[model samples]
Target: MENSAGIVKPQYVTFRDDFSFESGRVISSVTCCYETYGKLSEDKSNAVLVCHALTGSAHAAGFHRADEQKPGWWDSMIGPGKTFDTNKYFVICSNFLGSCFGTTGPSSVDPSTGKRYGIRFPVASVKDMVKLQKRLIDHLGIEKLLAVAGGSMGGMQVLEWGATYPDMMKTLIPIATTHAITPMAIAFNSIARFSITKDPRWNKGDYYEGEFPVDGLAIARMAGHITYLSDPAFNDKFGRRYSAFEGFYDFNGFFEVENYLRYNGYKFTEVFDANTYLYVLKAMDIFDLSYGRGSLSDAVELIKADTLLISVSSDFLFPPYLTEEIYDIMKYQGKKAFWYNIQSNYGHDAFLLEFEELDRLIREFFADRGL
Candidate 1:
């Protein structure tokens, strides 16, 4: 990357119109917290909308304040000369509808009752998230985006954007994601949800005014975090090492991995809401781009944008085969598509870590399209 995007501030916008959710439910009035780096071109054709993974905020790059210790999540791959190249593309990122990070979600107050939606919030979908994003894009007066890109759950939104609104963007980048969630992935999610629901403090998702379900939320984060890394990553980082060389017979003798996960789990509770977690996890569990479109190939046929599908070799959660099928289908249809498998022990999170390789591939893909 050439340089940073410098200190930037987040922006907020609220839409008072009714939002029809995929679950046949509706909510009136929602707000979005967003951030933008770089400037829009005169014709507004250079705008890029970047979607974030589960639990990610809208700060995709740059320092939000002068003394902040860390920049945005994708700082390495964004900015002036990175693949996203804020200098050339007006990059935007928004917290999804059911997110806790400065966006309206289960944690937000309901207009009807003046109370947090809690479990009363409608079930949100990847398609619903994309439709909300379309509103933000329209608010900015951009007719079409230069590209839509993200990883994990964010990638699900990317694919949805292509399938639901084929002419909205010029390119699609879906990294470490699947068109349809598998039974195995759903099983893990079920366990995570169970961990929360069984906690007495959860109180059927109405604990905002009482004891927060920190313990349950921590367990849920721990379960979800495991799927983000590979065994090799775990082994290399923690292995069988003891937390403090305590006795093996200590009964609670903790491994370094256990300590690590516990620390992260608790830390996550500091920033995220339990209800938001339940909602977003439910959204991911039901995400399927091919559903209601006849079949996978039929769904793919609706896309007009060029696609770049990225997968990680050790991402057993989503896996490389899922991405390969996307590539296979697009090619069989004579659609412009490219695929790359990053060989990394970091597993599904390789897309977030392997910045140099990712930049190269994205650079080439954009160049081929003369973007």
Candidate 2:
């Protein structure tokens, strides 16, 4: 499949009769589309899975072979000699099950009825997404991985992997994320969901073939974008800069910051589907590492591998407090774990922005393992 950008769509396999979720619905099948970089070593232990963020796709660190215009989101950190050096590790990045980019989601046609699932797609959780990932790894014949690393929503998945399959990874990195959704995070996500559901065009989420809820989705993105940056950072970026237009006679605000946010919202709509965004955000809100276990320490004991917990000092969404809690628990449980709280004004998005230090840290970590 070719996207509008002319990128050659990734090849994928649909696993029928995969595992069911705690919600009691057996997802009849799961289709996972992924992109691979570097060559798999003979032992297959060099594999590293890079899970994408909430609105991201399987494309992680390079431009598609078919299109050079759009490079992967983490292009800065994954290269020949970068943090996740493709030169030494076979990297796999997959579009999560509930994503819109070539993977089955609300926009996908329901195989049973030959129509889109839309709102009817089974409610997916972080666990369900992790299960689909397991199938994808099994299909790729990778029995073990060097690491499973990601940030934000991706970080949530990394934690889930450690909980769900503790023995599969040699190292784990979950950055700028939480062990579970906090009340404050839930409040933000709830408002975002409300924006989408309140749109007239949402049509009970059956808007696949009709006009989309662009305005609502745009508003949602705009709202979430606020959490991605700190107030000081935003002030430095825009402050009181006026909009480019001369005299503001229009209803749109005259502040340059307003214009920037509007641009972000509009651009997001063009590349993302509204329904998928809702589903993924909902999944993130529902993720809680402390769900089944009585204590967070008990949960950390379940992880049977060396873990590196990375957090940003200024992040408010998944605050450093959560990462600190996980770190403390891992130590209490006698797990080999290291913690790093990067100092930056970038806030929650620091993990994606602060690369210089990240590069140094990752290099040292991998070298210590003789990679």
Candidate 1 residue spans exceeding 4 A from truth: none
What is the per-residue lDDT of model 2 for residues 46-121, given as tens digits with 9 covering 90 to 100?
9999888899888876667743776777777776766877678888888987889987888899888999989888
Per-residue lDDT over 179-295 for candidate 1, one digit per residue giving the tens place of the 0 to 100 score: 988898898888889989999999999999999999999999998889989999988888899976568889778988899889999999999999999999999988888889999
- What lDDT does the true structure give each of the candidates? 0.92, 0.84
Which ten contiguous residues of candidate 2 have the minimum total lDDT?
1-10
- Cα-based lDDT at residue 112, candidate 1: 97
Best by TM-score: 1
Error of 1 at 39 (Å): 0.4
